[model samples]
Every structure is written in structure tokens, then in C-alpha cells.
Target: MMVDVLYLTAAVCFIFALGGLSRAESAQRGNLCGIFGMAIACVAAYLSVNSADFWFILIAIVMGGGIGVFIARAVSMTALPQMVAGFHSLVGLAAVLISFSACFAPELFRISTPSGIKVLSLLEMGLGSTIGSVTFIGSLIAFLKLQGIYKGHSIPLPLNAFFASSICCLLFYFTVTESEEAFLLLTMISLLFGATLIMPVGGADMPVVVSMLNSYSGWATSGIGFTIGNHLLIITGALVGSSGAILSYIMCRGMNRSLWSVIFAPEQAKANDAVASGGTRAFKSGAPEDAAFILKNANSVIVVPGYGMATSKAQYALKELGDMLKKDGISVKYAIHPVAGRMPGHMNVLLAEADVRYDDVFELEEINRDFSSCDVAYVVGANDVVNPAAKNDPSCSIYGMPILEAEKAKIILFLKRSMGTGYAGIDNELFYASNTMVLLGDAKKTTEDIIKAMRE
Candidate 1:
């Protein structure tokens, strides 16, 4: 009865934790709830086991807890997505290993005469192990790419007989594999397959990749539940897997991309030229004093942030500029697009770190309705989020993706360092908009200068 109660409480906490994570205001609380719930579940699981090997479990727990704490404290928010992917990969790998252990256990295998139930279990174990192994290696590669440990380059797929031959070989191997050794070999091959798959995708596609891997992790855990006959694990895993798939689909649509394209296309080959469109007309650059002059009298200003802000650690400067504008009685608001930075909620983490007020931040939905009302939109080192191509040009790669219509504002101030394209290798149409004024420099320095100008 106590065990049932403990499990029920764990389930409730997990649900609430996930619910809380849906909003920025409650994210921290959600994280705490998740941690606490996981703790309870772990304790209950260990207690339920009647075995006498408590010392081994204690040591494992202590080591795992120590490592987890170190990682959480050490990793920066910029690399959080990659870290999460790698962590999920580990979970999948663990599930696979556990399932494999159960399948080949000496005592169980010795007693069975290969009944239909045994065959089905073996098949499930093989499938789980293969998929989990692939997810593990794929996520590791993603982590390497995001960390700059690997050269972020695209790998082209063979289009002719080589591709056809490889697929045939993989199919033949899968069809013939019935033994545990063959399953292990297949797992290794799938791992290699996953590594090759994610290597061709650029950093810009990481959010979707992370979500997809999350789903794989969940499914792998579900397979573990099948192997162990654990209902709770199965339910939790299904919940995570389904939700992750939905999130991945949404992210793909948000980027005007297909999951297949992301999985298969060469990153460089799939580049979109956003600034080269017919509507892209570059205006004469304005002097800082002139730019300041125009912004000073603006009735409303919207600030847009991107990955560049995180890379340069410029949120503090941005907030300072916002304060100066607010002092001038200009209504200031921040516009955040979902895929603005390297990861999901990237800009929000940085802004929160800088102690920016939650109320001042507006989501894409809220800010879109107010774009026309905004006198000026100051784009800080963002390229794709403010690009008009996402909405206007069907021929463009990012067509159909939602964007901040900063072009509609009477004045658009873009702060960027160079003509070099963003992660998608696309020039920003927002940079060339008629009302747009480019301030080419380091984001933090330019923002600090603007704040100084405002003060003077």
C-alpha cells in the first residue's frame, strides 16, 4: 500500500513538473519538482527491491548524484541543448543495455525452449537495443558539433548505386539476424548510422534534433518497461515519447522545414539566401547620432534578441538600453521568437540570468499583434527571426515560418558585426528593409554605445 502511494505521488509530481515547464515564470519551480519527484521514485524503486546488495546501490547513487551536480553546475546555458541530448542518449543506452541483459540472462534462457512469448520478447529487445544504440551515438555527435569539438560540416549522401547497395545490405543483415551476437552487431551498425545522420545537420537545426532524440530516449525507456513488465515506466515513457514527437513536429514546421530534409540533406547545400531576394534593397547606413535621433522620438520600441546576444553576453547592455529608453518615456518591449537562438528558450535563459523582468518580455504571438503599433524595432544580432523571407518569399527555404514583422515598423535598427550570414548561411532580408538601419559592429559594444548616446 505504501509503495503504491509513493508511486502515485511520484506520477503526480512528474505531471505537475512538466506542466510548470510550459511557461517561463514557473520553469524554475518545475525543475525543482521534477528533481524531487525523481528522487522519490528512485528511493521507492530501491526500497522495493528485497535484495541485500544495499552497499552497491548506495555507492552507485552517490557517484551518479555527484556527477550530475558537477555537470549541472559546470555547463553553461548556451550548451544546454547539446548537454540534454547527450544526457538523453545516455538514458537510451542504459535502457538498451538493461534490456539486453534481461534477454540473455543465463537462468531465464536456460529454462526456456524458445516459446512464442520468448521470441516476441527477444524481438522487442533487439528492436529496442538497435534504436537506443542509434539515438545514443547520434546525440553524442550532436553534442560534439554544438561544443565545436567536431568541424561543423555537411556530409553529402551518395545518390547512385552506393546508396541502394548500403540499404540492401542493412536490410539483408536485419532479416538474417536472430542471435544475440547478430543483434549486437546490428546495434553497432545503427549507432554508426545515427552518427552519420546527425553530422550533416547544422547547429540551427539542433532544437528539432534535440526533440527527436528526446522521443527516442522515451521510446527506449518504454522498451525497458516492456522487458521488465513495469507499468509506471511504460506510461511515463509513452507520455514523454508522444509529447516529444509533437514538439519535434511543431519545431520543424516553425522552421519551415521537413523532418526528412533535416535528417538527410547536407547542411551547406540546403542554405537559404534570405537577403538576395528581389525585395532586398540595402539602404545607406546611418550615423550613430542620426540613428539615435530617430529612436529618441519613437513612441514605442520593440527589442529583438538572438543567438548573437548569448554568444557575446550582451543581455545586460540590452537591458541598460531598454532602461534608458524607458526613462525617456518610450514604451519598450522585448519580442522573443521560439527558435530565436541556438536552443529552445535560449534568449529567455540569458535574459533571466541578467535579471530582466518577466512582464517586459513578450512572446511571438503577443508581439506580432503589436508590430504595426511599434514605432521602431531594434534587432540585436538576430538574422532569421526578423527575416521577411519567412513570410513573403515562397521560393525561399524558410518560407511559411513565422517571423517578427520588424519591417512593418517605421524604423528598424539592426546591430550586427559583419555581412557574413547566420547559421543557416542566409542573408537577412530585415537588414535590407527600407526602414531598416544597419549598425555594423560588435553587439555588446554597439549596444553599450547606444546606451551612452541615450544617456548623453
Candidate 2:
């Protein structure tokens, strides 16, 4: 009863944590709530375990915690997406391992009977391991791709066949045969399916891919939680799985991509891995000094950020430029695309790290129309979000995606390394527009140079 009480309390705390994390102002409070809830859940689990298992569990806790803390502090923000993917793989792998243990020692898990293992228990083991196997390998591929360790550019394999056949076999084999060999073979198939499914996805789709893998990990955890009779794990897993799914849906909508299309990695989506530029389109180039003069005279400026900003670590200098502009009585705001950077909220987090005020930032829907009235649309390391091709080209892969309308601004200051496409690998017609000024250089150095020029 005490364990049940603690579980209920932890569940409530987790709900509160989710509510808190949904808002920027209460995010810190939310984090504290989550940590507290996990602590309580850990205590409940500890109380339920055998005395003989105590030392082993304690040692595991210590080792895992030590590694997590080290990675958290050592990893850079630019690499956070890969870190997250890596963590998801760990969760999935843990579920698979737990299922294996349950299979071997059913009596220890309280599922053995005169009639053999419980049907419900067998189903749980099968599902948990199957989903967990896929999640584990899929997340690993995502991490490798994000970290630039794997070149996953070959043609995508037939995932539809793998997904359908594997699940059908797992269900039938686990329920009818109830044999260990069937389970092992089906689990191997799931792992292979996951690897093939995600390996060929282009970088532009990484955010959605990460979100979907998170959802998979959550569902896998929940399935294993039922096998182990852990209420807290069930509740937490549901929350994470559902939230991840919703976030994935929202991001796909933002990118004008169908969720089914992204998950399946359709032919059309994979076709855009190479550049779509029509052989050396003409565009205007400018220096940091020219950008400085424009900023000096502008009445309103909106900064649009992308993944390039994250790689170049330019958010700090961008924040300084914002402060300088505000000091000189010019209005400044940051425009964040929903799918900007490598993950959801990536740009927002970067801006917050740079100490940019929350009030000055707006999402795609919030300030898109304002670009028309704004004097300068300062695009830093952004390409596709401002591209007109999404609206103009029906044949393009990114067609119908919502852009920031940066082209409508009186003057567009494009900060990028060259006249290349963004992650979507499609050229931005905005770069070649009459109003756009492409300033080629590292974004951080260019922003600093603009600051120096303004002073002179």
C-alpha cells in the first residue's frame, strides 16, 4: 500500500512536471518536479525489490547516474540531438534486456504457473522486446547520422514489408508457439527493420525522426512496465510516448510533411538528398559592413535562425546585435520556425542560452505577417524557412511548407556560408531576390563584424 501511495504521488508530480515544462517561465520548476517524482518512484521500486538484489541495484544506479551526469555536462548544445537519440537507444535496450530476463526467470517476476507462463505475461514480453528492438537500433542510427559518424545516404530499404511481416510474426509466434527461438528470431528481424528504415533518411528530417523514435522508446518502456507490474513506469511512459507523438505530428505539419510519409521514408522524400539548384543561379553578395549600415538605419529587424546558427555557435553574437539595436531605439525580434535547427525548440533554447528576452521571440504563426512591415529581415544561417519554392513549386518536395515571409521585408540580410540550400537540399529563391543581400562567412564572425562596424 505504501508503494502504491508513493506511485500515485509520483504520477501526480509527473503530470505537474509536464504542465510546467510546456511553458518557458516554469520550465525550471518542471525539471525539479520531474526529478523529485523520479526519486520517489525509485524509492518505491527499491522498497519492492528483494534484499539480495539491493547491492546489485545500488551499484547499477551509481554507475548509470555517473555516466549520465558526465555526458550531460560534457556534450555541447550543438550535439544535443545526437545525445538525446543516444539516450533513447539506452531506454529501448533496457526494455529489451528486461524482457529477456523475464523470459528466463518468470518465477522471479511472479508470472510462472502450473499451466506454464501466463498468456498476458508472454504477450507483454513479446511486444516489449519487439518494439524495444526496433527503437534501440533506430535510435542508434539517428544518433550516428546526427553525429556525422554514419553516411546513411544509400537508397532506403523496403520498410513496409519489414514492419508488417515482423509484427504479424511476433504476435502469432508468441501467442501460438510460445517458444524462445521464435522470440529471438522475430526480435532480430525488428532490429534489422529499424536499421534499414532510418538509415537512409536525409538530414532535413532528423527532428521528426528523433521525435518518432522517442515515441517508440516510450511505448516500449510502457510494455515492459506492465510485464514488471510497475505503475509509475506505466504512467511516465504513457506521458512521454503521447507527448512525443503529438510533437512529431506538429513538426511534420510545420514542415508540410505527412507523418506517414516521414515514417515510411517515401521515394519523394528521399529524392531531395541532392541539391535542387538549377545550375548556378545569380544572387547578390555583401560584406558585414553593408549589413551594419542597413541595421543602423532600420526601424524594425527580425532575426530568423536555422541549424547553421547552431553549428556556428552564433546565437551569442546575435543576441548582442539585438541588444545593440534595441539600445539605438530600433525594435528587434527573433523569428523561430517550428522545425528550425535539429530539434523542436532548438532555436528557442539557443536564444535563451544567449540571454535573449522571451518576449522578443515569436513562432512562425506569431510574426510571419509582420515581416512585411519590418525594415530588415536578418536571416542568420537560415535558408528553407524563407524560401519561396515551398509556395511556388508544386513539384518540389517541400512544397506547401509554411515559410516566415522574410522575402516580404523591405530588405533581407541573408547570413550564410554560401549560396547553398538548407537541410532540405532545395535552393532558396529568396536568396536571389532583389531585396536579399547574401553575406557569406561564419555567422558568429559576421555578426561581430557588424557590431564593430556599427561602432565605427
Candidate 3:
């Protein structure tokens, strides 16, 4: 009865945690709720286990907890996506390990009958193992791409769909036959399938990939939960799976691409046909003083931040600039693209870290129309999100994707290091817009210079 009550409490906490995460204001509370819930669930699971398993579980907990703490403290915000991928891989691997252990000791797990293994138990084991294997390798590949270990380009494989389907069929057959050799074969093939699935995806779509892998990891965990007959794990896994799926869908819609296009037809969406034409366009350049002068006189300003801001660690400098502009009676607002930076909500996270006011920040849909009435649109290290090509040029890779409408502003000031293309390897036409001027330098240094000029 006590254990059941604890499980129910943990479930409630997990739901609250997810709710809190829906908005930035409640994100911290959501984290706290999740942590407390997990703690309660862990205690309940530990208490339910036999005395013989206690020491092993204790050692595992201490080691895992220590490693988690160290990684959380050491990892920088820029590497958060990679870290998340790595963690998902670990979760998948855990499911695989547990499935194997249960297979070796069916009596201990209560899955074995006097005659043979229960058919339902075998089915659960097979599904859990297959999903876990795929998730483990898929997440590893995602981590490699995010970490720059693997080139973030699609690797074409002939008959990829046929091979994947065949593998699934074989895995199902092996599960029914209860063949140990076939189980090993299924694991290897599933791993290969996972790698192939992610290898074709480009870097620009990594946010969606990360979220999709997270969903896989959750489903894998739920499969293991079924095998172990643990209701808490089931509930937690379902929550994670559903939430991850929703996030992935949201990201896909934000990029104006279907989920199918993101996964299977990524090459079509990311092909760069406009690269040759980009070099012929003319653009105006400006200095820090010019930017400062324009910004000082502006009646309203909208600051757009992207991955470059994160790379340069310039959120604090940006906040300072915004504060300065606000003091001059200029209405200042921040416009955040959903898929900005390397991950979803990446810009918001960085700005929040620098203590930027939440009320001052607005998403693309909210602040997009406001750009036309604004005096200046200040772009910091962002490229694709503010590019007019997304809306105007059908030949462009990012065509039809909704943009921040930075071009609609009376004046556009871009802070960049060079005229390089963005993650999709396509040039931004916004750089050549008649009303736009580029301030070429390090984003942090440039922002600091502008701030200093304002003070002077």
C-alpha cells in the first residue's frame, strides 16, 4: 500500500514537472518536481528489490549519480544538445542491458514458466531489446554529429528502406521462435538501422533529430518497464515519449517542414542551389559608431539573436545594449526564432542565463509584424532566421519557412564575423538588402564597442 502511494505521488509530480516546463517562467520548478519525483520512485524501486540486489543497486546509484553531477556541472551551454544526445544514448543502453540480464535470469525476473518462457514476456523482451538497440546507436550518431566528430551531411545508402524493413521482419521472427542466435543477429542489425536512419540527416535538422531520439529513448524505457512490471517506469516513460514527440512536431512546424521531410527527404529541403548567385549581390558595410548612431536615434528596436551569439558568449553584452537603448526611451524587444541557434529554445536559454527580462522577449510570430513599424532590426550572429530568401526565393533551401521579417524594418544592422553561409551552407540574401548594413567583427566585441560608443 505504501509503495503504491509513493508511485502515485511520483506520477503526480512528473505530470506537474512537465506542465512547469511548458513555459520558461516555470521551467526551474518543473525541474525540481521531476528530480523529487525520480527520487521517490527510485526509493520505492529499491525497497521492493530483494536484499541480495541491494548492494549492487547502491553501487550503481552512487556511480551513476556522481557521473551525472560531474557532467551537469562541467558541460557548457553550447554543448547542451550533444550532452542531451549522450544522455539519451545511456538510457537506451540501460534498457538493452536490463533486457539482456533478464534474459539470462528469467527465473529472477519471474518471466519463465515451468515449461518455457511466457510468450507475452518474450514479446516484450524482444520489442524492448530491438527499440533499445536502435535508440542507443541512433543517439550516439546524433551525438557524434553535434560534437563535430562526424560531418553533418547525409550519407546515401542504396535500398535503405528495404534493408530496414527486412531487419524488422527478422527480429519479429526471432522473437516468435525464441532463438538466441537470432536475438544477437537482431541486435546488430537494429544498431546498423539506427545509424543509417540518422546519417542522412543534416546538421540544420539536429534539433528535430534530438527530439525524435528522445522520444525513442522514452519508448524504449517503457518497453523495459513492461518487461520488469514496473508501473512507475511505465508512467514516466509514457510522459517522456509523448512530450518528446510533441516537441519534435513543434520544431518541424516551426521550420516549415513536415516531419517526413525532416527525416527521409532532408536532402531535398537542404539542397543549396542559390550559392553561386550569392556572390554577385552587393552589400553596404558600417562601423560600430555608425551602428551606435542609428540605434541611439531609433524610436523602436528589435534585437534578433542566433547561434552566433551563443558561440561568442555575447548574451550579457546584448542585454547591456538593450538596457542602454531602453534608457534612451527606445522601445526594445527581442525576437527569438523557434529553431534559432543549434537547438529549440536555444536563444531563450542563453538570454535567460544572462538575466534578460522575460517580458522583453518575444517569439517570431509575436514580434514579426512589429518589425515593419520598428526603426531598426538589430541582428546578432543570426543568419537564416532573418533571411528574406526564406520567404522570397523558392529556389533557396529554406524557402517557405517563416522568418522574423527583419527586412521590414526601416534599418537593419547585422553583427557578424564574415559573410559566411549559415549551418545549411546557404548564403543569406538579407546581407545584401538595400536597407541593411553589416558590422563585421566578433559578435561580443562588436556589441561591446557599440555599448562603449553609446556611453561616450
Candidate 4:
């Protein structure tokens, strides 16, 4: 009875945590609420378990917690996406392993009958194992891509759909037959399906892919929850699954991509790279001093950030620059593209860390038109999000994607490592625009130099 109350409390805390996490202002509180809720849930779970398992569970928790803390401290903001993917994979693997334990010891889960394991249990375990296996391998592949291990390249298997369907059918058949072989076969084939599903997807859709995999992991957990008769697990899993799915859809819309197109027709995304291999395009270059001069003289400035900013960890210096300009009677605003970085809200996280004022930041739609009337658009370590090709090149993959109209500003000061294309592997026409001046260097170094120039 006490356990029930604790579970209920944990569930309520989770609800509040999700609500808090939706907005940046309450994000820290949300994290705390989540941590508190999990602690309550863990204590209740420990109490419910047998004495024999107490030491084992405690040891496992300590080891896992130690590893998690170490990784959280070591990983940079730029690598957060891959790290998230890796963590999601662990959830999936946990689900699969739990399903195995239940299958081998059906009596422990109270699903075994006089003749054999309950048919319903078999079905639940089958579904759980299948989804879990897929989520595990799929997330690993996503992590690899986000880590630049594969450069977003996908392995093409023309018969992927047919093979995946066939495996599912076989899995269902084996589950109905109540064969012990189902678990192993399900894991093996689903892993293959996982690889095939993600391999065809281009790098452009990785954010959505990560969200979808998260959803898969959640559903896998829910299926196992049903098998184990854990109501709290079911509730938590449903929350994660539904929320992840919604987030995925939202991100797809942000990229102007249909969810179906991103999932079933990765060829469209791959097509973006075909014309990206052209020779070096002519573009004008500028030093930090040139950018500093334009920034000082500008009446209004819009800052656009991307993955490069995260790579250089330039958010602190960037905020300093914004503060300086704002104090000099210049209107300083931040423009964020939804798909600007490797994951959703990547730029916002960095900027927030640097203590940028919330009121000064605006989304692509909010600040895009303002660029036309602006004095200077300061693009820091961003490329595709502000690319004019999305608007001008109809034949390109990202043609329909909405972009920040930094190109429309009176002057464009673009800072990046080089003149190369972004992850989408397409040239940004904004680079060669008449008003644009590309500043080539480390983003943090360039921004610091610009700050020094401004102070002089």
C-alpha cells in the first residue's frame, strides 16, 4: 500500500517535471523534479523487491550512476545529441534484457501456466523484444552518425521493407506457437531491421530520427511493463512514447519535412548531396576587424547561431558581444532556426548557458522578416539555417525549409571554420551574396577578436 502511494507520487512529480521542462525558465526546476521523482520510484521499487536481490540492485544502481555522472561531466554541448542517443539505446537494451529474464523465468513474473507460458505474456514479450532490439541498434547507428563516424552516410538495402515485414510476420508466428526460439530470433531479425531502417536515412533527418527512436524505446518498455504487470512502468512508458512522437512530428515540421518522407523516403534527403560536390564557389572574406566595424556602426543586429557555435563553445563570448552592442544603443536580437544544430533546441541550450536574456531571442518566424530592415546580421558558426538556397534553389533537398532571412540584412558578417557546406552537404548561396563577409577562423576565437576590436 505504501509502495502504491510512492508510485503515485512519483507519477505526479513526473507530470510536473515535464511541464516545467517545456519552457527554458523552469528547466532547472524540471530537472530537479525529475530527479526527485525517480528517487522516490527507486526507493519504492527497492522496498518491493526480495531481500536476496537488494545487494545486486544496489550495486547495479551505483555502477550505472557513477558512469552516468562521469559521462555527463565529460561530454560537451556539441556532442549532446549522440550522448542522448547512446543513453536511449541503454533503455532499449534494458527492456530487451528484462524480457529475456521474464521469458526464462515466467513463474517469477506470474505468467507461467500448467502447460506453458501464458499466450498473452508471450505476445507482450515478443512485441517488447522486437521494439527493444530495433531501438537499441537504431540508436547506436544514430549515435554513430551524429558523432561523425559515418558522415551521415546510410547503407542502402533495396529489399528493406519486404524483409522487415517478413521478419515481423515470422516473429508473430513464433510467439503464437509459444516457442522458446522466438526471443532469440526476434532479437536477431529486429536488429537487422533496425540497421536497415536507419541506414537509409540521411544526416539531415537525424534529429527526427533520434526522437522517433526515443519513442520506440518507450513503447518497448511499455510492452514489457504489461508483461510484468507494472502499472507505473506502463504509465511512464506511455508518457515518454507519446511525448517523443509528438516532438518528432514537431521537428519534422520545423524542417519542412513530412514525417513520412523522412521515414520512408530518405532518398529525397540523400538527393541533397548530389549537387553538393561542386568546385569551390567564389565568395568574399572578411577579418574580425571588418566585422567589428560593421557591428559597431549598425543600428540593429540579429545574431544567428548553429552547430559551429556549439563546437567552438562561443556562447559566453557571444553573450558579451550582444551585451556590448545593446549598451551602445543598438537593437540586439537572436534568431534561432528550429533545425539549426544537431538536436532540437541545441542553440537555445548553449545561449541560455551563457546567460543570454530570454527576451532578446526569437525563433526563425519571429525574427526572419526583421532581418530585411536590420543593419547587420551576425551569423556565428551557422550555415544551412540561413542559407538562401532553401528559398532560391527549388531543386535542392532543403528548398522548402523555412530559413532566417539573414541574407536580407544590410550587411552580413558570417563567422565559421571555413567556407565549406553544412551537414546537409549543400553550398549556402548566402555565402556569396553581395552583402556577406565570411570570417574564417575558430568561432570562439573570432568572436573574442571581434569583442576586442569593439572595445578598442
Q: How close is every model to the real structure, measured as TM-score? A: 0.88, 0.96, 0.95, 0.94
Q: Show model 4 residue runs off by greater than 4 Å.
A: 269-272
Clashes of each: 0, 0, 0, 0
- lDDT of candidate model 2 versus the reference: 0.87
Q: Write the per-residue lDDT of candidate 4 for residues 1-456, one digit (tens) a residue.
A: 899899988988888888897777897898899899999999988877645677788899999999999999999877889999999899989988998998889988889989998888888888888888889989998998888786544545556777587777866786788777767877788888887788767766788998899888889979998988887788888989998898898788887888877877777644666767678878899888889999999999999998889889999999999999989999999999887787787888789889998888999778877998999988988887887888888888778888888888999999989777786778888888888899999999999999999888
The candidate that wins on TM-score is 2
The top-ranked prediction according to lDDT is: 2
lDDT (C-alpha) at residue 346 in model 3: 81
Residue 52 Cα positional deviation in candidate 3, in Å, after optimal superposition: 3.9
**lDDT, residue 324, candidate 4:** 94
Given candidate 1, what's the lDDT at residue 115? Answer: 40
RMSD of each: 3.6, 1.6, 1.9, 2.0
Q: If both were scored by lDDT, which would come out higher, candidate 2 or candidate 4?
A: 2
Residue ranges of candidate 3 with Cα displaced over 4 Å? 23-26, 157-159, 273-278
Task: Return the number of clashes found in candidate 1.
Answer: 0
Model 3, 1-456: lDDT tens per residue? 788889889999999998997777898998899899989998887666645677788898999899999999999887888999999999989888898887778887788889777778877887788889889999999999889899755656565676578677876787678777776777778788788888888877888999999899989988988887778778888988987898899888878888877778767644573543345667899989999999999999999998889889999999999989988899999999988876777888899889899999999888888999999999999888888888888877788888899999999999998887776677787888889999998999999999999899
Q: Which model, 1 or 2, shows the larger lDDT?
A: 2
Tens-digit per-residue lDDT, 1-456, candidate 1: 676677777777778888897886897898788788888888777777666888898898899889988998999876777678779888878876876676567243332344423555555566667667767887888888777888655556763235335534553554355455666666766676677777778777888888888888888877766656565577678878887898788778768788888777745334454444324345557666766787799989999998888777889988887887888899989999888876667788888888788899988888898889899888887888788877777766667878888888889998887766676666666766678888888889888877677667
TM-score, ranked from best to worst? 2, 3, 4, 1
Checking candidate 2 for backbone clashes, the offending pairs are none
